[model samples]
Target: MAAKKKVAVAGLASVLLVAMVVAVAVTVTKKNGGADSGAAPVSTASKAVQAICSPTDYKATCEQSLSKANTTDPKELIEVAFNATIDSIVEGIKNSTLLKQAAADDSTKQALAICEEVLGTAVDDLKRSGGKLSEIDVSKVDGYVEDLRTWLSAVITYQETCIDAFENTTGDTGEKMKKLLKNARELSSNGLAMVTDITSIISSLPMGNVGSSRKLLAEDEGRILYHKDPSEYESGTEPKFLGKVSRQLLAHVKPNAVVAQDGSGHFKTINAAIATVPKKNNVPFLIYVKAGLYKEHVEIPKGANKIVLFGDGPFKTRITGNKNFAGGVKTFQSATVAVNADDFFARDIAIENTAGPEGHQAVALRVSGDRAVFFNVNIDGFQDTLYTHTYRQFYRDCTISGTIDFIFGDALSIFQNCRFVVRKPMEHQACMLTAQGRVDPRSTGAIIIQNGDISAEPAFLAARPPIDAYLGRPWKELSRTIIMQSNIGGFINPAGWSPWMGNFALDTLYYGEYQNRGPGSNLAHRVHWKGIRQITPQIAASWAPGRAFAGDYWIRATGIPYVA
Candidate 1:
């Protein structure tokens, strides 16, 4: 079965090479005012003639044209040079015996298919290459040009060898062709591997450093100073002009009530307040935190279910910490806010980890709750900022910011009408919105961004990378994420999804996009992944907050009453 598939693939590749060759011939001849005679017949002499007129023979001419054209528009010249090289190789392959053998070999169809697939990918790489080159520093352009030239030369040689092997059909010739096919496959794999490596290296190069002024407010400076204290914080026992309130106001509040830095004068640090409540008790605990800066790390253990944390205001209440994975911490252990408890609710507060660009996977908020909710909140960080670690979670009217893999986790979560601000990375600009790690195929975990605006801090960084950045990447095998009815900004990469770590993950991950608008929502250049889905409005609607995947059980846990 495998052999047959290979043969079919080979046949398809042969046809594509033939078509490309014919197209280039017609285009060149027509441009030169020559008679548009149909493709020349395939023969030994024809193959010999083509080999003699290899791309090498015209290398000088091609280079001269490219140089001249590049002076006017380097991008156009590079594209022309690239296409011409491909054209030369395709033309050479069309009349070769390899094309005939590929068409005849049923066992080698899958191998041929692999060739075609690689070719298609190469074409895309070429297109993306132009923009990629532009992003490189001027000093590195020459190096890139030289490398591309060398790669192209090797590619042309490979094509020629494949052609020559195809032409020979005798016992020895057939064996030779099979060997050539194997070599061709290896070359394709190597080429792709090189491209992936080079692209990653280039993408990670620091483009520019993020300005220090753009950093989030420090824990000490983020204290809430409201003009008038709300009645909710005032208790009968406390009565002074701008006086502290009693804990009585928290009586009606649930036992696991969560108090932020902006709450009544009760607790100092936010973590201290979170620690005051028992993890397993059903009895409600009132955690009233005074309005002040609380620079502390907080984690609610697994048994600590049904906890609530209230704050004075979303912007005023601040919980900040910073830890990064590169500092020898596992990605899971680098979170500032790690909530393992189920039925957790937080409102009117901001949770942030200030680990800068140097920190790789420092998490600001890690929620693994079965049913967790965040309302009128803000989560800030760079890479791996907000970790919806596991289970179903919901966020309503919140703000989130990050750089690479900012919003990542292995959970089914929904962000409704939230603001996503992408902070540009200083080095090679690769900012991703979300990285969902849903390893289980049966576990339908996802990150759904519904009705949001993708904004950026720096005005220049607002224009997302052409191909370097992505809306998201699948951190797990069956990972799924969707952006629906959102105002996507220009900062989004044209290829909406990026490889998680390498191409291997691309095969197993499920990434999708639906009903997104604005400059960043262009689907023309999206990655052609088999698992990437194009969802319909109905399908997207089904994933809505009150719908199947995110339903009443999840919504009610958020403490916000939902009709559905």
Candidate 2:
């Protein structure tokens, strides 16, 4: 099996290389072609950690966080770091009470009020991740980082919220407050580094001997649950995979709740309709919200599993909220729409946080549900726009717009054929499009953006000529993200990926681009980082939502269009 997979990988790589040259030539030429980014080959050296903290981006933090750990393995280091992040976030939460009381005004009080719940949620999330971590046998799984990364991604999201509470605000949220979050931030960052190390170890493991007659198309589902085929659709042929069904075909999915702001439907508000849902139904409880701006905060709780939400269209239906960092709503709680149930679905709707550019950490949508799907939806905000907070998710034919860290969170998600709109930032501020939070070697989650459009607002791009918006920066040293076979715009910075802050672990983070087109698709000048790979078709296919992210099964269940 291993030998067959290896042969398949090589065959796919060859096909991808040739296809990349012919396919992306025009786009590359538009901005100075030839994409020999001089990216180093993926390291095939022994991945056994020489020292527990060696692979981590933040060395000091890694050392301190792993101090109590008994093993030097990369997997153990990741576990320790997650625990450390939990410890630090818990400490920060404890300190938050004092800060809230010492706050000068009601705004500060409000910010701190939300922080408590946000931090409390972090504790719960980390505890869950920690528990999940203990169950992963690094030796057996090819890429077991999904659950671990999902949990750590949640921690990273929480930590960002912890600090965002101080942004653009007047009060005691000064350097001292930031200092309170330093430990948690560092631990969270280390989790990203740990994940990269684990992948490296997995890569170093030798393939076992196997027969040559095996064909990948017929692998058992149980085997697929463990090992992903190294090639997708034979590599070079990047087929335009579509949804198995169309909207008209899916119209039979009935609704149990109807919401319209004018009271012309079953309910006047989205919240009101949610109140009528019976928890844990065997079948989906679809909620249809009519076209209108509904100004309310809504949460689809865990008990509301298998709930579905659909609207007229992303442009026609708008759900808006104004909870922002300065307004004292904790970043996590500031989401205009928060989905907490498993098997949740949203289609043709717009979710927006009205908090503008200065309201750092306002989230339009925060999804914590497992097997969630958002199709033809719009997630609009500035600074932390769409948060795939946890679990396995799929976003297809959707539009997500924001300024800083727009696409963030730790869902092992697939953003397929979506439009990532890069909004302009404050004067002279640089734009970093994504901040993926994967902090464990065992984590299966990474931001996979494929066959999509990455562009900036036309006016914004015109105003900021010689553009600066970038593909992304790692929220942690081990952050993982990919832009593949997509139509990229000129807004992207030539350097591609950016560092988290102040020359952090740019080398250890896993950032990649494969067969992307457009003026911004030129990978020649991308930041020369050790872990950054100009993905071959073989590599890209292996990480497909169907194979790696496990989106193939659940996404299909959503009755949405997807490549997998």
* Highest TM-score model number: 2
Candidate 2 per-residue lDDT over residues 1-564, each given as its tens digit:
545554444443334333433334434344452346553322111112224445566777776665556542444456667777888888888888988888887656766776776677777777776675455432223334444555565666666555655656685564665788787777776776565455444445453421111122123332332223434214442211212353323333335678888877899999989988887654566688888989999988756877778788878889999888766666767888998777787888899988888887788899877778889998998898888776788899999998888988777778889998988777777778888876555455588998999888865677734447888888865788988889988778888877888767677788888888999898788888787876888889987876665324456655567676
Instruction: Name the regions of candidate 1 deviating beyond 4 angstroms.
Output: 1-264, 459-467, 557-564
The TM-score of candidate 1 is 0.53
Off by over 4 Å in 2: 1-253, 279-282, 358-360, 464-467
- After aligning candidate 2 to the native by TM-score, how far in Å is the CA of 540 from where it should be? 1.3
**All models: lDDT?**
0.56, 0.70
Q: lDDT of model 1 at residue 183?
A: 33
lDDT, model 2, position 405: 89
For model 2 the TM-score comes to: 0.66
